[model samples]
Structure formats: C-alpha cells, structure tokens
Target: MEFSELLEQAGGAGLFQTLLLLTFILPCFMISFHVLLENFSASVPGHRCWTQLLDNGSVVPANITPEALLTISIPPGPNWEPDQCRRFRQPQWQLVDPNATTSSWNEADTEPCVDGWVYDRSTFTSTIVMKWDLVCSSQGLKPLSQSIFMSGILVGSFIWGLLSHRLGRKPMLSWSCLQTAVAGTGTTFAPTLLIYCGLRFVTAFGIAGIFLSALGLMVEWTTTSRRAVTLTVLACSSSAGQAALGGVAFALRDWQTLQLAVSVPFFAIFLISWWLPESARWLIIKGKPDQALQELRKVARINGHKEAKNLTIEVLMSSMEEEVASAKEPQSGLDLFRVPMLRKRSCPALVTSFSLLISLYGLVFDLQSLGRDIFLLQVLFGAMDILGRATTVLLLSFLGRRTILAGFQVMAGLCILANTLVPPDLQTLRVVLAVLGKGCFGISLTCLTIYRAELFPTTVRLVVLFFLPETRGLPLPDTVQDLESQKSTAAQGNRQEAVAVESTWF
Candidate 1:
C-alpha cells in the first residue's frame, strides 16, 4: 500500500497530523523571514558627501552649523539636497552666517568627497551601506551581497538535495539548522564587509535546508486528501512570516540588532525541530523498511491505532517492495532534463523565475525611494502578499489551473506596463500602480506553482521540489517515451506550490 493509503487506514487528517503540520510550518515561516529581511537590513538611507568647508580641504570655523557649512561646501542638485557624491572645492563662508545672503552657490566647482559621507541616520543607524561605506564607487557592494546570498541558496539546494538522499533528511536538517543559527547570528559580529557577506551566504544555505526538509517531512506524513490543502496553506503561512519580519524590523531599526533577532530564532527552532518525525516513506525507499516500520508505528500510536503495535516490519516491507518494483530504477539527475516535454517546461520556468525574482526584488528593495512612508509601505507589502496568495487559492477552487495562471501572468504584465508608462511627477500614482503590479506578480507566482504541479507532476524536479512528497510517487521514467506515455494521468494526487521561493530567494 502507498503511504497515503497507510495514512488513510491509520486516520488521515487528525490531531497528530495537525501538530506535525504546525511543526514543519515553523521552519517555513523562518525561511520567509530570511527572504524579506534583506530589504530592511541592507537598506541605504539618504546621504551626502562629508567635506571640510574651506579654501583648502580643511575644517570650517566651529561657529558654522552642519547645514550652513553644507550649503557653501556642497554642490546643490535641482531636487533633493546637495550632490550625494560631490562637494565644492572651496568654502563660501558667507553662507554660514544667517545674516549673509548666499549667491552663485550653484557655480562652485565640485569634487567627489575625499572623506566618507554623513548619513541620514534617523531611520537606520546601522545598515549594510553604512557599515562598509557602500556609496558611489562601492555602491555595487550592497546589491552584490544580495546576489551572493542568493547564489548560496542555489548552490545549497543542489548540494543539500544530494546530501539529504545520502545522510537522510533528519540529520541534514538538524545540522543545517545549526549552521543557520551559528552563521546567521555570527553575521552581526563580523568585523569586515567580506566576513559579513560570507556569513550571510552560509545563513542562506541553512535557511534552504530547513525549507526543504521541513516541507518534505510534512507532506510525507499527510494523506492525499490533506496534501493539496496543506501545500496551499503552508505557502500562505510564509506571508505571515514576511509580515512579522516587517514588524520586527520596524521595532529594531539597527541592522545588527535585527540580524541578531532573526538569526537567534533559528537556534531556538533547531532545538524544537527534534520533535519532528523522520519520513517513513524515505526510509522504506532507501531499503530500510524495518526502520520505516518503526517510525510508522510511532505515528500510528499517536493516532490511537492499536493494531500498529502488532504490525511487523516484514509485512510493511513486502507492501512497499511491490510499489518500488513497478517503478523503473531511479534514473540519473540528468533524466529530469533529458525528456523533451520536461525540458520545454523546465526552461521557461527558470526564465520566469529569474525574471520574476529580479522584478519583484527590484521593486521591493527600492521601496524607500517611493514617496510613501517606508514602514507603512512595508506593512502594505506584507498585506498585499498575503492577499495575493489567498486570492490564488480561492480562484483555484473555481478556475482551471492553466486559465488562472495565464490570466494572472497577463494581468501582472499589464500592471508592470502601466506602472512604466506613468509620468515621473505623479509619485502617488506611481506608488499605487507599483503596489498593484507587485500584488499581481505575487498572485501570478502563487498560481504558477499550483499550475505547474497540476500540469506536470512528473517533469519538474526543481531542487525545492526534489524532496517534495509528490516527486516520491512519480514512477521514474526509463526513457523520453516513458514520460510522454504517462503525461495523461500525471496529475493524479499531486500538489505543491511555488516553494521555488526557498531557492528563488535564489
């Protein structure tokens, strides 16, 4: 019997399963927390070049106020304050006194700041930008750090996917959680930008592992009836974490403090993760049915199944062997891409993910530039994200997967186009349209995950989905022809939503 059948026989959806779901969802929430926190923690605030106000590059008279000295010593821009990177070569001391009328300040010849910039620190006292003086010549470092963290996630997905198969899910998850706790919390203490970036990358790998293992365990334990609903709800739960991250960031404006707050939770979660059960199906597939049966009996006892005590390993092994036998021997990882249909779907999915991530993050991380209040806007972002996913789930109940995915994608595209065409002066309109576009992107992505799963359960072995329960049941295809033959019924009892965010946070 399939594990789903076993779960059904043992009482499919009940208190035991509910607790298991909640346990796994904790890691999922933390994963989302890591994804969105990068925005606030790395934010660069308003700044201008710090300069000495004098004919030579020497300090101005002590009587001068910072703003008055800046008026004479910095080159002004038509909008927003003085030039961010440049300052006047010589001081116009008249501007320092309130009684003197400043004249021809725009004509002063300017040079780049010889010293570092003075930051507007009211909102953020410490951030990635300030920590390393990542402005002007070094501005790329901030975004580069973001990309490096993402690269670590992608690398971790492939590496940990293999390790999970070798070391088993539970051990790898525990170790990864330890890695996250240590590396993530250690990031706050990093003395240099290089060290901090490295720690961030390490933290991402741990986040990826928690994401994969927790998701794998939950789906494996549930029956088919609960699996689809479970996946959808699990995804929405991440939005809750994103929302909470905004609140946390709002409360603790210091980047180091925020980093410590988010990072410490992983260590606590690692302690709690001991309560998670190992996947019995994974044990059986790995030719350890005796161990699988032992775990299953524990689950059975939790569900109040008395016969579970009488169940023997040999009986369970015999049942599992039949299903394993019908499937072709597990093919190479290349098999996921070898088939024509799989490649066709896989290519666009990657392109869509890359483009979607760029657009989504670009918009979100630049949110401070928008005229809206940053804190409220972040809260709005979380609310919109939750609403978007919830709307997708609601629509799925009524519309065909393809129709819904196509419709949402098209609408998202249109919203982006509209936002692009809006005139520059209308900041309010721009913010409104930007939020609308982001909301559409959120919904489209949420639907794409559901659509892809329902569309081709056998094709996508994306790293995030590698440990997914749905992948477990797909009888490995021996040839491209085998994939074409099975495509018809491939949708049966399959459901996983865009966990690609775990790595797409690749």
Candidate 2:
C-alpha cells in the first residue's frame, strides 16, 4: 500500500485534518484583507482648491456660505463645479452675479492651487490621498503605490518559492506572517510617501511568502478526496474577508487605522503556526523517516487510529520509496523549463495565470470608476467572488479543469470587454458588467488554483507546476514518477475515466 492508503488507515479526513483546516481559515481571510487594502487606504475623494477668502485662512465663513465664497476665489470646472486643481488669480467678485454664464468665466484667468487643496470627507474621514496631498498633479502616486506593492510580491515570489521547499513549509509561513504583520502595521507611522511605499513593499513581500507557503501546506496535508472542497472553502473564506473589509473600512474611516486593523491579525496566525503538523510526505522525501514516522503517529493518535501505533519506520519508508528515490536528483525552478515535457505543459498554465491576474486585479483596483458608493462596490465584488466559487463547485463535478479554467477566463474577459461598449451614463449596466466579470474571474481563479496544485509534485510545487495528473480521488504525487503513473491509473478503471479527460491538458 502507498502512503496515501496508510494515511487513510490512520484516519483520513478525521480530527487531524479537521484541525488543520480550521487553523488555515484565519490566515486565508487576513491575506485577502491585504490584497484589497488599497481600495480604501488610497481612495481619492472629492476635492477643490483651498483658497483663503476670509480671515483666519478659512474657506468657510459666518457671513457667507462656502459655496458663495468659492464663486469669488475658485474658477468653474468643465461641469460648472468648483475647479479642483485651479483657482482664480484674483477674486472675481463680478462672477458672483446671478447672471454669470459659461461665456463669462470661459476667459477667466486661473492658476494652479499653490497653497494646498481641500477634500470632501463625507465617505472617508481620511485616506493616503488626504495624508500626502496626493491630488491633481500628485494623484499619480496612488496607483504607483499599489504598483510598488505588486512589485514586492513579484520579487518575494521568487525568493520564497525557492526557499520554502528547502527550509520547510511551517517555518516559512510563520516567518512570513510575522513579517507581514510588522510591515503592514508599520505603515501607519510612515512619515513620508517614500517610507510608506517602502513599508508597503515589505508588506507585500511577506504576503507573497505567506500565500506560497500556505498553498504548500494545504496541498501536502489533505488527501485527494478533500482537496477540491478544501480549496473552495478557502476561496470562499477569502471572499468573506473581502466583503468584511468594506464594513471594517467604513467603520475605521482612517487609513492608518484601517491598515493596522487588517495587519494585526497576522500576529495571531504566526503564533498558531507552531501547532500545525509538518507534512510527513515532505519529511520522508527529505530523508527524515524518523521525524515523518513521529508526525504520522501523532496524526494517527489525534485521529483515534490505535493500529497506527504499531506501525514502524520501515513501513513508512517503503511506502514512500519511489518519492524518496526521485528526490535524490537536484532540482530547481529552472527544471520546469529545462524538461521538455514539463515545459510543454507549464507554459500554457503560466500564460493563463499571468493573464488571469492582470484581468482580475485590473477590475478589482478600478472600483472607483464605477461611479457607485465605493463601500457598496467593494461588497458587491466580494459577493460575486463567493457566488463564483460556489458555481465552480457545481461545475467541477461535470467539467474538466482545463475546460472550466479556459471557459471561465474567456467569459470573464468578454464581460469586462463588453463594459467598454456601454455608455458611461448607463451606470447600472456598467456596474452589472463589472460584477459579472468579477464573478467569472473568481471561478477562473478557483479552477486555476486547484489545477496548478494537481500539475506538480511536492518538491517543486512551490516554485511552479505540480504532478501531471488529475487529483479527484487519487493520492498526491510526491515525485515525477508518481504523477506519470497516474496516467495508467486513469486508464485502468471505469471510475477513473474522468481522470484521463482532466489530465489530457498535459
């Protein structure tokens, strides 16, 4: 019998697996909070030039309304509202007349706001835009900050991807969670935009590590029977976190407070990491049969499997002999490209992953363009994510992973592209398209997550690609051979027919 069969004898999907799943829920939710943090933290609010029209350098006056005072100091914008970036060179008292028309102000001389700008704080009491005066000419910094954070994630992916497999999953996860909590909360004290961007970059770096390490833990810990369901639950939890962020941001109303709120929980995740079980499969592959045996016995004890206590290291070692032999070869991320068969299969997945990320985040970060209440929009997008994942659960029963992945990606792209044809004035239609696009993207993401895990082995799965096999009810492939043999497994039985359809993408 294989190690997977032994795992079942030790009580598959029992108390041990249940506890492991519960441990991951918080980390998954907190990670989602950071993913959408900027939506509230860097939001741009309504604003106009701050021109002192009264004593005390105040725009508001006891004698005149703020709007009436703006008529004298500020110029009319394209929509007849106060110009946000520009103001009259001198007070134009004549424009205060009721007869003022577009022609009257069309030739008015105006200059950029030299002193500073005033913001409307009705929705958000404070944001990074308000803190740094990132308005008008400086407005570009808002997106740049998010871009910087993304670059950190990209850099960290390469670093953590290579290190986690070598060092171990739990340690990397704990360290990354601590790093994210520290850097994330540290953003509140940033005295300058540069410092804030630096802290956010570090925060994103830790986030990438956290995500990769957590994925490794999840894939290695669960049996095939629960893999898809487990992934769906995690995805749904992420959506719940995103939806919860809208409410949290609405209550906090300050960027500093919001940043701290989302970040501080990671500290708890770090503390909880000590209790998580190390992957026995990974231990055995690393030539630590004694440690693997101990971990397995612990699992069996927790799962109430008395027979497992009688098991010896020899039985454990023999069960994983194929995987242990495969691990003798040195491998790295480059191997994914160096191996012709691996390259042929991974390239499509790589392209699909890249395109999906671009489309999904492009839609996610552009929420303000929808012209609806931002809080409402955030919640709506999150709700659609939940709905999409729920839909994927049903579709997976009848559809191949490649078909679902490709189909959803195409549908999501169509929904987002279709939004371009809709007139801006039709706000409801545009929002509908955006929400549908998010839902499709969510389903695509869910499919991609499970599919990628199934395509590689435990050793290199963190870097890129997994075993080239379907993972519906089979054991995890700990080595390349373990994956290749799955092709024959699929052909051997009537129940395995669907596995062949799924693995054909390779």
Against the hidden true structure, what lDDT does model 2 obtain?
0.82
Score each candidate by Cα lDDT.
0.68, 0.82
Q: Where does model 1 exceed 4 Å of error?
A: 53-67, 78-80, 93-108, 306-315, 326-330, 450-506
Reference-based lDDT, residue 183, model 1: 94
TM per candidate comes to 0.84, 0.92
Clash pairs, candidate 2, are 455-466, 455-467, 456-466, 456-467, 457-467
Residue lDDT tens for model 1, 128-208: 798888988888898888888888888887877667755677888898899999998999999999999899899998877
Evaluated with TM-score, which candidate comes out highest? Answer: 2
RMSD of each: 5.9, 3.8
For model 2, how does the per-residue alpha-carbon lDDT over 129-246 read when each residue is reduced to its tens digit?
A: 9999999999899899999999999999989988887878888988999999999989989999999999999999999998888888887777676777777778888888888888
Q: Total clashes, candidate 2? A: 5
